[model samples]
Target: MRATAEQLRALRQEVAGLERWQAETTPRRMPLGHAEADAALGGGLEVGRLHEVFAGHGADAASATGFAAMLAARLGGSLVWLRQEQVGREGGALHAPGLSEIGFDPARLVLGLLPDPLTVLAAAGEAARCPGVGVVLVELWRMPRPLDLTATRRLALAAETSGVSVLLLRVEAQAQASAAQTRWQVHSLASVPLEANAPGHPALSVELTRQRSGPPGGPWQMEWDRDRGIFRAWDGGGAALSGPQLPLAAHG
Candidate 1:
């Protein structure tokens, strides 16, 4: 049966109203590690969705880990770091101080170097469904073929419903297209002086390679101070502290 013009118009209005309601109710903003990145990200990383950071092969894992830890820490919740390969042997364990400086409780953070990517994804989906977890970071070299868009969309929806943030950290060269909301490429920037004239530690330079909802190709830089176990922004003026200024939570 063909619908009349008035009926079609009414349906369109109803759909528009529903979209507006969803937009108003959805939690759409998160604090990115860097202010510039946040601006480029259209706010910050959107909560309740999957964001991908693709640090290409030969990319510095320390910097990538530090960046992820810093962001996760600010979000203030339990974090699960899933590694695709063995951590102790293949690469060094993720730097604990890097996360600590960002204010993540060591006890709340769970690190797992899984043998299978599917297992990690499954765990992330479950975590997203649960309210206990605040964020889940999955570090994988690649995604198995069978776990495609359907699987990812399921996770995304779960995150939305449960208010969890899922971050997928892929090795620089290996991160191919996926159903992620935002994708980034991170590189290590040269260290600067901690104080005026005093030498400072190195930091990470991140670029927003792709984003579903915002502009791409941002040269956002953030520094990880090993001694302090914290992350700060790197402005050309100096290594001044920038980004979200939330209080650091005490670690257990």
Candidate 2:
């Protein structure tokens, strides 16, 4: 027999209660491959959450994008990346070979080049809801009005329902109120040169600026390990790179 309207309403209420319980009691953190960062994060970044990364400056756009892309890569699944067309023109498009260097499969990527922030935000919301999509990365040059708190809240909700991680890459933007689980800023650091003056591995100075679930901590020097597809602490010389080598190219 079909259930009565009252019974259906009660069932919906029960399901909502269960979802709340699970959210409160369970935190599925994926270790980010850095001990200090993991400790500050209370283990690691939570899966199925919204994370934001900002460029330390316009010149750091490459590092910021690379940081977000690396996180999406670590998430491990089909990646849907949405960005404004202008971003590609200004900060360099997502290059296939560059991605390959970092262990991200180009075949698993779905790239969307939209005309404006509104379009990108709309696409990002939908992508976050898609099943089988491992990660949704939305790159915005600056904080646009269309990507307000309400928009992020929707994205966060979609991520929670679909169990997909959403990465927001903000270049030349300031931090604002949002529903992001964690917020970070990345700046390129001159890598320690390898044998015979070969440029060092991709090194970056990263800071965990904010978070909703754990104490904010960081400002760590990190190196991207392409072979392992993870961020490792960089201890080259035990000091931040200096002089002309401090500035890295915009790709990585």
Candidate 3:
């Protein structure tokens, strides 16, 4: 049956309204496995939203990537990671063995190595809208002209519509305005020692700088347990100090 022009117009408006409503709705949260961090996040990380992770230093690229990978691992489903080509040339390439060492499956991963940030963002935008993907990791170094607020908003919208989590890994980039549901600064930390002075699990010091729905949280000491597939609340045997707290209204 053919629809009249008015009926079609009404249907379009209804669809647009529904999309707007979904964009405003709170995404489902998944426990990130740390009590303190989870509490600050109001349960856990918000799935189906855009989040940012900025590396704290030149040497922290690996740490930031690791943190992003761990978060992606916990989010469920296949992982699609889009990274600037320069990142691999400067820092290192994403290795299968290294990924497996941290409990993420190399088999379920899809990667896009793009020449520039714009291309990377283009690929990421498409990946974020894919319902088959559980997480989309956009790894870029420094600030790029194309990654403005407008690009981020589109990515966030894609995430909301597809119920896919997007984690933007920013190495050597300063914080700026964006549509990220949460923003973080992450750096490497010494792993706890083991029996016979063996290597310990992956450890990271992450600070929550901004959150859209709640107050910022963290600067927590987190150690990822590969065998258990969870982040354990760690002090690193007194390896960290309490970070200065942010105002409750900082993001709320």
Q: Estimate each model's TM-score.
A: 0.74, 0.87, 0.86
The worst-scoring run of ten residues by lDDT in candidate 2 lies at 238-247
Per-model lDDT: 0.69, 0.88, 0.88
**Residue pairs whose backbone atoms clash in candidate 1:** 55-172, 56-172, 56-173, 57-172, 57-173, 101-229, 193-200
- Give the lowest summed-lDDT range of ten residues in model 1: 236-245
Please, what are the lDDT tens digits per residue for candidate 2 over residues 1-104?
Answer: 59999998986886697588666867578888988998899989988889999999999999998888899888899999998998777888789898988889
| Model 3 weakest lDDT span, ten residues long | 238-247
**Candidate 3 lDDT over residue span 155-211, tens digit each:** 998888888999999988998889999999998888776655555778999999999
lDDT of 1: 0.69
| Candidate 1 off by > 4 Å | 1-24, 85-87, 95-98, 195-202, 224-232, 236-252
lDDT of 1 by residue, 125-196 (tens): 777787788888877664466456667676666666677888876664465656788877788776654444
Candidate 3 matches the true fold with a TM-score of 0.86
Higher-scoring candidate on TM-score, 1 or 3: 3
